[model samples]
Target chain A: MPGALHRVLFVDLARHRSWVEDRADLYSESLGGAGVAIELLREHCPERCDPLAPENPIVLAVGPLTSLYPLASKTVAMFKSPLTGNLGESHCGGRSAMALRLAGYGAMVIMDRSPTPVYLSVDAGGVRFRDARTLWGMSSSLTAGRVMLEREGGAGHRTVLRIGPAGENLVTYAGVTVETYRHFGRLGMGAVMGSKHLKGIVIAGNGDLPVADRGAYQRTYRDLYTRAVRSPAMRKYYELGTPENLGPLSAMGALPVRNLQATGYGTEPPLEGEALAREHLGRRLACSHCPTACIHLAALREPHPEAPYFYKTTFVSYDYEPLYALGTMLGVEQPEDALRLLDVVEHLGLDAMSAGVALAWATEAFERGLLDEKALGGLRPAWGDARVYATMLECIARRAGPLYTLLGEGVDAAAAEYGGDSYALAFGGLEMPGYHTGPGAHLTHLTGARHSHLDSAGYAFDQEDMKAGQSRSPKELARALLTEEARRQVLSSLVVCFFARGLYDADTCVACLSAVEKERNWDDLMALGEDILRRKHAFKAREGFEFDALRIPARTLEVPTPLGGLSENTLREAISEVERLLASGERFSHG
Target chain B: MGKRLRVVDVERCVDCLLCAFACARRFGGGGLAKSAIAVRSVGGMERGFVVVVCRACEDPPCLAVCPVGAIRKVEVGVRVDADRCIGCSMCVEACAIGAVQWDAVERKPVICVHCGLCAQYCPHSVLAHEEV
Candidate 1:
């Protein structure tokens, strides 16, 4: 291990005292990234502490492979979620991982809430806290990022992670946007930072990393880079980006439409990937050391409301989740309107998925007469009304009125207060992700700790089942998802993007790991992956999460999927079986 | 067998820094510490990046500033004699682009050897090894 690998940088916002401590034990066992971050959170976070309180600790970590390998670009941020009041973990990509790693530290732990708005700047040598009073409360969060870029020293080699007014206002679903387009998009991690009066974090560093075997490492790196750039899976991402999934998901009836009220929206011209590629896609972007370049920036050319002759073009990045959440889930028919809504959410620095679900719930509430102009403060909530949705999204971030405040808390909390729990598109208190495949998808969300479709990729498993015609018992499905998710812990710990799962199979990963540190073999790697998953689940369980506590939205079962209509009983049975399998100490073996 | 290495068109560089990685890997066994060239954002990434490497100046300030006579003008570019380097960091300060990278771990200065390994790895033809 490098001499600097053991040191943890500690930043105190109130006192502005920063220090580094050598904790090699944590790094040696946990292996950095989410693994070490979780350990730090356990030690620093007070039990049942208020997530927004000065006591809550935010830990960001980078793995050993960062900046040394391709696709190891994600930074793991772990803290108590202000949204769910449980263990919070969000992974982000941009220049964050490389910056943090190069900055001569393995991890950073921020604690002690600030008295006033501030941002932390870290370089290769030291850390400094700067007052952000002038930069705070900016409507366009990008303005703050631009200011930081100009004022701060590091330019291309640094990452600036900033929050918008949404986070400043403490919107529970607010997120921290980094490198302009990348985000710690889920679990209200931004709200935690805002609660501490933290406006942003900027990191820049340039240092040579020490390795065990330079010759083997270099050869392996070239091989991985070659494979990453040439893979077919990577080509799809580079070409159409994630929006490519939008068309196929919609066609397969997996796209969540109108808050999952309908699986398919016939009235709307399908907002598919192919359509966006033909019309809106302006440019492609990628994270540092990443060749996929899957980021799609869409150019929306529109006449400025004030200046009709002068048309202003806005470029917004679009993806599968955002497209589904803001377009189909909100009943938005016109692609332009969806893009506009996406632009508003992006500027606000709120999670588009949660914001769309919140808005969809509000629209449904209004349609059912559960909410009216009185509750909405004279603002009519309607589906497919992009203008109304845009205004409401901003209002929600700003916490304007009673309705906006409720909506800002997310769909689960909003529905609980407004009598629409039946249609609330949430799982494990977090809003549902884009997928609505079938019983498999719902079951995956219910069983997975994150309650996210990515938890177990149940949709992909559904596709596999379609091909295999093998109806394994619910236990079999749960075991498979759990094993796959556990294996992903290795990827996430290395902080690699999940999109590259095909490229970094277990064998390839072992080969790469051997280049860095030859001590560990394939089995050791697998064990570490399992241990990390268990640790994450333990944190969730400690926060009162139970497999049975998972709620399959009433709307999901009501809507027929492309696979078939998912029955409540089947989903419930699967959930119970999954719980049983999880409770039992059965080691899931992946062949 | 010595060859002069210079960047042909920097505008084509996507800021990937593959050349730097490749340079480091070519010498350091496989790690990034040994790479002689460095890439940094010029101002903001929106503006673009600047590739920092030895310009192979006729009167290289790095060589003149080395207190321990550690730097020498090689056939292709400047090379560092690690045995004599006292970790003085004079060469690093002498170079304007900060191309003379100081290895804090190894207590030595890393100067580009003009090997052109980086140019071979750069998929985009942003970096070129030219005999000037």
Candidate 2:
């Protein structure tokens, strides 16, 4: 193994001291990325710790194939979630993984809290705590990024992970904007950073990496790069990006529209990805080491309100999740209106999925007379009210008022406090991602350790079942999802984007591992992945997560999916099956 | 005639860093340590990127300013003789375009050899190699 991959960096914000530790065992046995990051989190995090407290550590990790292979671009960030109050794990692309890996550490653990606003400047030398008082409280995170681009060196080679005023206000779903387009967007890592008074973190390096076998490394890189660029699987991503799914999912009656009041747009939706691309696409970008540039930035041109002739163009990044949450889910039909709401959320650096779902609930509550206009802070929650949504989203992001503060805690918290618990869309404190496919989506949301769709991708499983024209039994479905989740841990541990799951199978991963570290087989990875997932579940269990006590939102059962109405009893059976499968897992040992 | 690598389409570059990685691979390893090419965003990514490498100047400033006479003009660009180099970095200072990449570990300037490996792996046809 490369000597550098064995190194871990630890920083205490309170003392403002930074140091590196050589733990060869951590990397050699567990491998890199989440494999080592989860172990570090277990050691650093205290039991029954406050999610916002200094006891909760933020562990950012990169894998062995990070710089050596294409599409190995993600950095896994694990912490105690301010939203879920359980295992908080988010993966970010952009230059983050490459920056941290090249900065000469496989993993970084940030602890303690700063008394004043500050940002960590990390390079090959060490970490520097710079005062960010001037940059703090900026409404737009993009403005802060621009200031950072000028003030700091390592342009192109460095990543600036920063939060906006929403984070400063401690919005529970606030996300850390990575560079300009990507994000650690789920489970509120930004809020955790906010609680610690950390404004931003910049990682940059111009360091060398040692490859165990140069010839094998070159061969593997060539094969992977060719496959990534040449394959049809990735073409969909680079061509039109993820918004490509908006039209299909909507047509298939899987898309959630108007707070799940209806599925599908019923007609050719105006906010379809192809239409958005043709009308608003400004640029396409790639994460470091990724050939497919899937990050699509839309050019939203708007004239200044007072000066009609003058215009200011903004570039907003859009995806399928945001389109569902902020667009169709709110009955937002106009492409520009959807883009505007998306821009507002992006500027605030809040998780769009959570914000959109929270807004949907608020609108429903208002419709049901559960929330009056006074409780809504004199703002009305109406469907497709983009102007109103723009203000409301801002309110939620900054926690501007009492109502907004409740909304910022996520829909579950708001519903628990207010009288709208029945329709609130959150499964386990964390608001659901944009999928309303069937029982599968809800099952994953309820049982997945992070309470996130990416945790198990049950939406895809629903689609596959739809294609086959048959649905599996509850026990069969649970076993399949658990197996997939464990297998995905392997890819996640390598820290690659899940989009590349087709490429990095067990054999291929083992082959890649041989070029950097010692030879390890597929069984070793399977065992390691299972062990890591069990540990995450163990953490969540310790943190008061009860699978049986999972809430089944009334809206989930009321809405008829493409797969027909999901049986509540079947959903419960699936949950029990997951518990059973988890118990029958083998343990991994450190060699 | 000399073969040299050049930017074909600046707008087409996706900022993947494959060209830079391929350049570093010529050094027989991974990472961007000894890469001669640099691709950086012009302000922000929305504005596109600027690719910097040896422009193969006829009367190279890097060759002219070398205090130890370690740099000499080759067919197109100049070559640095590491044995004679004193690690003064005068050549690096003299290159106005910042094409002379300094290696901190070796205390030497890493100049592009015009190997065309960067062009072959560009994925998008943002780079090109041609006889000039």
Candidate 3:
């Protein structure tokens, strides 16, 4: 921790001044990423600060393992969510972490608000606040990023983070786009950036970093690279990417179709992974240090309507989540329709999961006669109609009318305002991710931090139980889920991509950390992980989060899961057990 | 036979920068500042990447342009001598493909010696050390 990993950069946007501080002690204890970010969030953010207010600080942190190890590619972003209004934490895997680390800093904190639109230009010359007035109000995040990329002038070793019109319009579920296709895609981090009158952040640097043992570092790096390329654990992602889940999940009767109305596709699901790969998969991409290259892009070729013999080609990024949210969840029958809708959301800078669930609610509400053409701005809400959904996304991003504005607040707020709570499909104020596995998946969403399915991966656990033909008590299930979640804290704190969790096991994690820093061992790393989780919960509790007050939507209980009909009482009991376990963990007090 | 670094497939490059990392590690450190190899996207990575490195030109413009005659042609590529170099950066401008990457900290041009250390770590086989 002698070099960039020991320092923290702080930028006060309101004051238009910045400074760097050596926080070696903090980095030594927290080990960076979510661990360091949570401590910084507590120190900089006030207890009752409005999530969208200028006083709410944004913390971007990278871990010690980043840039030195393979698949240690994620940067942890901590902010008070404009969507959830609690702990807003999202991890992005792109050039974000690599660029920040190469720029010679372990972490960066953006505080206060700028009076006018601006972007922070970080380079070897250090931090400079650049005027972004002309770049503001761009049609898409890609355009804004391009404008900044040309002006800033760091082509190969740089990362440009920008938001599109949805974020500029203050859509509560908007996300920040990184590179062009990857994103810090959940929990309204983009809206928080918009509230500060910030348009983008440009990072560029190429400084050398120190290691505890150079020989050991090289050995560990080579071992990791070999495993990443040769391991069977990564073969699935290497072959078809995460979209490989589509076939298996659909076959298991766990894929949620048309807003959880049905678990299976019935006769013929129009959009299967194999078919998409055969017909449309144009390219494969990866994060900075990852070799798996799981990110897939679809090539959509269409003829120009106005002219003959003219064709237009568009590349759209696709993943299991977007395919589940925009494709199956919206009752989209054509793969082309799903890709078109995905392109619209990417252009508008909206979180596809939230946008899809909100649209699904609106479609159901329209069918119930609750939403009329006047409310919809003359557009009709119908399933499998890609054109109508595309227009609706534009309207929501622009906040075209009162009804559209409500939809911008996410499905939870929209449902509360328009009276559709029973089937709104949001857990703990955040839109649900794509999963209909069993009670474990549902319980994970309700109890996990950030309301993310990856927080615990209970769906995987549910499948294991079914395979074994064994049923565990609710307490047993809760313990198993929480234990795995607690262990994941170690991985995320190391800032490694969760996709490589199978490769970066506990022994490997300890070896990697020890290779970078001599002070940290296995016990110290485990203690740091547990402490980070506890501190996150403490931040939530201070922000007025109530564990017992969460409500399970009636549709969640109504749907027959793969394990059969799940009663409400079982989910409630699981939640109670999670609460008990969280309360019993060692307490944390701010220094 | 001597080793020569080769970009076997530009399409196979995922822009992971693992090869660049391996190049930097040759200096007994970590970072992109000292690496002699660089990978860049063609506008967008959707098309592919262009791996820029010293391809060992037979004529060698870098050797012709060096004022102090610090740069010399090697078996597979060019090598820069820090003692005789003036840090004028003429060699950087002379190279057509911008393969003569500079070491920003030392203000000297970093020409690859064709060590093939980078090719050893390239997981995708995008880079290889083949016999000339």
User: Where's the lowest-lDDT run of ten residues in candidate 1 chain A?
Assistant: A261-270
Quality of candidate 3 docking, DockQ? 0.78
Query: lDDT of each prediction vs. the true structure?
Result: 0.79, 0.87, 0.86
| Tens digit per residue, CA lDDT, model 3, A24-135 | 8888778889889999999999997999999899999999898888899999999998888899999998799999998888899999999999998986566889998997
**Chain A accuracy as TM-score for every candidate:** 0.96, 0.97, 0.97
Worst 10 residues of 3 chain A by lDDT: A582-591
Cα deviation of A539, candidate 1, in Å? 1.6
Answer with 1 or 2, whichever has the higher TM-score: 2
lDDT of 2 at B97: 88
What stretches of model 2 exceed 4 Å from their correct place?
A1-3, A154-156, A586-591
For candidate 2, write residues A1-591 as lDDT tens digits: 332887899999999999999888888777878888888998999987999998899999998888878899999999999898889999999999988888888899999999898999988787999898998899898888778757777533798899998888889899999989899999899899999899999888777788888888888888888888898989889899999988888888878888888888755875888888888998888998888999999999999999869999888898989988999889998989999998988899899999999999999999999889998889998999999999998888778778899999999889987878878989888887878787788888988878889888898899888989999899878877777787778888877799998888777898888986778888878888888888898888888888888888888888888888988899999999888777766332212
* iRMS of each prediction: 3.1, 1.0, 1.1
Per-prediction DockQ scores?
0.31, 0.79, 0.78
TM-score of each: 0.91, 0.97, 0.97
Writing each residue's lDDT as its tens digit, candidate 3 over B20-63 gives: 88899897768777888998889876778899998889999999
Number of the predicted model whose DockQ against the real structure is largest: 2
Provide the TM-score of chain B versus the true chain B for each model in turn.
Answer: 0.91, 0.95, 0.96
